[model samples]
Target: MTDYGHDLLFGTFTTPSAQGAQHVLDLAVTADRAGLDLVTFQDHPYQPAFLDTWTLLAYVAARTERIRVSGNVLSLPLRPPAVLARAAASLDVLSGGRFELGLGAGAFWDGVAAMGGRRLTPGQGVEALREAITIIRDVWDTEAVGGVRQDGRYYQVVGARRGPRPAHDIDIWVGSYRPRMLALTGAMADGWLPTIEYLPRGVASLPGLNARIDEAAEAAGRSPRDVRRLMNFMNVSFSPDDDGLLAGPPARWVEQLADLALTHGVTAFFIGGDDAGAIERYAAEVAPAVREIVSRERGHYGSMP
Candidate 1:
């Protein structure tokens, strides 16, 4: 068995509105009080119901002292690498090392194009994301490199410098839904946030996909074990009487989650919902049971020290 931190990588997401922001912050306080590990907010510039990820993370960071804050996955093409690098570093400094960065090349062509970002072909987007990660890491490096420039095919940075380098390395999670993106994440990221669920289709394809990732990492001279594997389940709930309920009761839902972890290799799960009552049910009933199960599975108990 692999040694791990708090196993139930539980977190929250918010719709981007004034009311949604307040609702999310309230959940942050609740998640913190309940001993959750991280809270994440998503980004969308064109949506009428969106809030700024960096600004909101900064606010959440200032308000909570113990819980970590993150973006579920920020759109990399939307900002210049230097600007994003500095913003992430500043947030990391303010949060005392509790900031995690999740990035993706981004979908929603209409939204990004509206803001002057050209659409990227799949290959171009992946290249851009790879370059973004490289630049961000160099900027966050406390030790200087021989050169301060990144000359990737899709992105370039010259004399790019910033920081008050993060107090600790910022954990970077890249969202990926395809083989190419998965291999890219394996080559460059700290974690893999798979878009697919842990169903039979995913299970059947795992070995081949993971082998490809292994090949890519080996080609890059990186160990496959260096990266963490994470999964996301949108709209999860527990139902004591009905497992069919997409949003069910607590005990039933927690059991499904435990099974997912034991049978599959799901180390982390990020859950999403639009209703307050659903989130409350998750935090109050489902979260505690899942945490207990994970602790027992690890042969350890109590909160992380």
Candidate 2:
């Protein structure tokens, strides 16, 4: 058995294009074959630029095993809680419980407007996110609480029941950029997955984000260790020369990630498949190294593999 958190795991985030779905599924099989831990798809609707992430992931899930699947970050605000919960629960059950839910306060204003909905202000969206999560969780656990209730603001759930719970409780990861978002993530999410734009680069920026997360978790009376820290990183290929990928060389990457696990309480890292050639390259050059890395981390983190 391998510890899910200890392993320096890597995966892909394919663009939500119909033409890409088949490729995405193919890549998923590739990840499983290559022994990678997870894969994710981004969610959006009627963009005319991407495929429906949930549908695509469902497609991929049907054809593979071992590899965990997730939404890079589902736009929770655009969806009604009961419907969304059912969708995720269905996926969870159908996929043999290998599902992760990545939730984000929808921010694509134009897309929202196009859907005949107004864009939510930052504050408004966050509040909406809060309500949305609560509603979904409630529906999954009980039959008479799946409807809507309001607290003088945002969409509220009344008195509806949500039954037929998912086979397993799915892990939830929240996306964040601002302090408030990060704070919320620390308090409520099972994990944190940040875009590359916000992940720390210099020595200074990194510590602050880590500190805030710890502070928030502590204040909330949750152990910082319970929440995972993950970086949404792009897999940049080197000519066997460049500084390697951000997670570092295969073995070093595992070591570095373990250090981060100890420091920031991170257990997962989402690797995006950017270059068209990354799949082949990782399969050939990076995959074997990672297998060994996981074996090492297994000695320390306990096994979920």
Q: How close is candidate 2 to the true structure, as a TM-score?
A: 0.83
Per-residue error for 302 in candidate 2, Å, reads: 12
Q: Count clashing pairs, candidate 2.
A: 18
What's the CA error at residue 302 for candidate 1, in Å? Answer: 20
- lDDT tens per residue, model 1, 1-305: 22224355766655546556677777777766666677777777656567777778898889897888888788887877767888888888878899988888888888889888878888888888888898888888758855458778878777865455886789788887677887898799887766445434754555566566667777778876656666666655554566542356677778766655554445676666645566667767777887778768756533212
The lDDT values for all models are: 0.71, 0.68
In order of appearance, the predictions have TM-scores of 0.85, 0.83
For model 1, the local distance difference test gives: 0.71
Cα lDDT of model 2 by residue, 1-305, tens digit = 11325445567766666766566667778777766667887778747678877778888888888888888888776666668888888888888888888888887788877887658888877777777777777767854533545453676566656755787878778888778887887788877777764555632355677677778988999876656767665554334333644544444544554444444445565666544456555555555555565556556665432
After superposition, candidate 2 runs with Cα above 4 Å error? 1-8, 143-152, 200-204, 244-264, 274-277, 280-305
